[model samples]
Target: MSKKKKIAILGCGWVGNALKTKMEEQGHEVNCLCRDINMDSLVGFYNCDALIIAVPPSDEYLDVIEDVYFSVSLNEAINTQMILLSSLSFYDNDKLIADAEELAKIKDENTVILRLGELMGYDRIAGENTAGKMTNDSTTNYVHRDDVIGVIEIIIDKNVRNKIFNVVAPIQSTKKEIFTQNSKKFNFKEPSFSNIIDKNNSYSSDILCDVLGYKFQKENVQDFWS
Candidate 1:
């Protein structure tokens, strides 16, 4: 059995809470931060074996980071090994890469950024609970939440740090393929689609599987819409 490590997750939203629960199940100690910026939390955060920053990027997110981790001494920031949950949609091209490269310097080299595609899982599939995008032939770039948490655990367990990895399923499918196969199970009408123009920033997980050896548990698109 792998040794248990203490982890401090700085966000307690849906993804954060789920990750915390999963990590706890695996025998790792987890501390979840749901309150506003607090120095006491940062003090505790600096002592963890690793940190997972799950807060989505927004106008004030940077400021929040400054309060939460960045404002601390460089030594303290260096001690906080982090796994940032980022979106692949933001870093999809050359120009975007140039911009994101600057944002990367905010954290120390020990931090790993896992860029996720559209999440698929209970109450979170593209075509269900609301609407879907992409055409019949447009390839779907998504991964289940279970796989996302799985990859995160792999990174922590294997000590994979200081890089960006796309946490998407290797399985490929069209929007219609997803809904058509699951229509009976989910009872959703076949939705229309449009030609998905941008593909440069589409999410995939070559580097992650290559580096960390994570096999996606929910590889099929139509396996879990219940």
Candidate 2:
């Protein structure tokens, strides 16, 4: 019988833990790297084949680089392929990731950088104001955690080489839409949005689907919440 492909998950906090559980269930050897590895007894168990970096975004580029470095160090057993869970914020107006992008380019081969948008699952967007949530003015790109990790699995299965892939749902929603629908679902008052509000927007799942044949599971956020 063929052995299972090993996959490592770094920063197993929220999304990382979910990815680890999903990946392992498919019979892939899973290794999880965490900030508090000592506290968690299950640190260095499996022979990891691909390293999935599930850390969140930060304003500081150096911190991103540091986290990536730490993730790379954890894979001593295999020539672990690197998957950096970067953000669409990298493509923002400020371009805060200029330094990080340069670093990523240097080690492009055998690495896949997933530039995901605002993730919508659990506490990530739970606190948004449901009442008076603004919808039309500001637009945000969101993806379910399942879709995001699914894209990662595709990248691994296809042996997707060095490149950036945006793993987002097809539909875009404004804060008003999200909060208003959420409020209605929970039997609360409708939410509203302000004219001054600005949100990040992008095309969803095209590169992953059209190019890599990966499908995004979350079609819309409204379905997930409402």
Candidate 3:
């Protein structure tokens, strides 16, 4: 565990909120940037040891960073390390990937971007959304919430900067495959998958583990489905 330090998370939705609690349990102080725009949380962001941008990318994507620096970019204390929680949505679209890379460059060494895959863990599998989302051959990436927490913690500890890490499971499996294998555990019928698999957008998160020397506990989607 790292020394206790102030960690300001910009968005405190499901993932971020869970991360805050996990970090705090490990002894780090975390504060969510909620409604208090004028508070020191955002205005004096540099005061914190780390800042995490957990919002999803949208039309207002640029405004997120703009608003953060609108008040205190000029301050000498604006050297706090930042982590941007991005998604693998950048992979399928070349232009989207280019735009995300361009946007990350603006922050330079102070920013660390993580392109996460579909997050699965804590009974988030085999639900309403999983039964009919993809084909048998539609391979997709996924990352456990535990792995996400571990990656963020290590990045902060190692002071990883000016980098983009792909956070995902080592194996890419389709929804049909996932459900077919785990249907018995859930007492549900197995989903039939096609012999065809979508290979275009398939990704491997092996690089993060290789670079950071971290092991993923959630190797199979079936592990978290129950």
Candidate achieving the largest TM-score: 3
For model 2, what is the alpha-carbon lDDT of residue 173?
Answer: 69
lDDT of each: 0.69, 0.67, 0.72
Q: Write the per-residue lDDT of candidate 1 for residues 1-226, one digit (tens) a residue.
A: 4689888787778688899999999898898765444554556654677778787666666655555555334445345566778777656543443344335546465568887877878776566643343343456777888898888888888887678888877876766677666654677765665555334334568778888877889876666554
- Badly placed stretches (over 4 Å) of model 1 are 39-43, 71-78, 93-101, 129-137, 194-203
- Residue 132 Cα positional deviation in candidate 3, in Å, after optimal superposition: 6.6
lDDT, candidate 3, at 34 = 57
Tens-place lDDT digits, model 3, residues 1-226: 7678778887888789898998898898887885455675445544677778787667766667656544334455656677888888777674644565566567555578899888877766653344544444566577888889889988888878877888987766666656676666666555566678656476777788888898877776556654
lDDT of 2: 0.67
Two-way lDDT contest, 1 vs 3, winner? 3
Report the lDDT of model 3 for residue 129: 49
Cα lDDT tens digits for candidate 2, 107-214? 545567887777777655532544444444466677888788788877777767777878778876666666666665666667554567665556666767888877
Error of 1 at 35 (Å): 4.3
Report the Cα lDDT for residue 72, model 2: 54
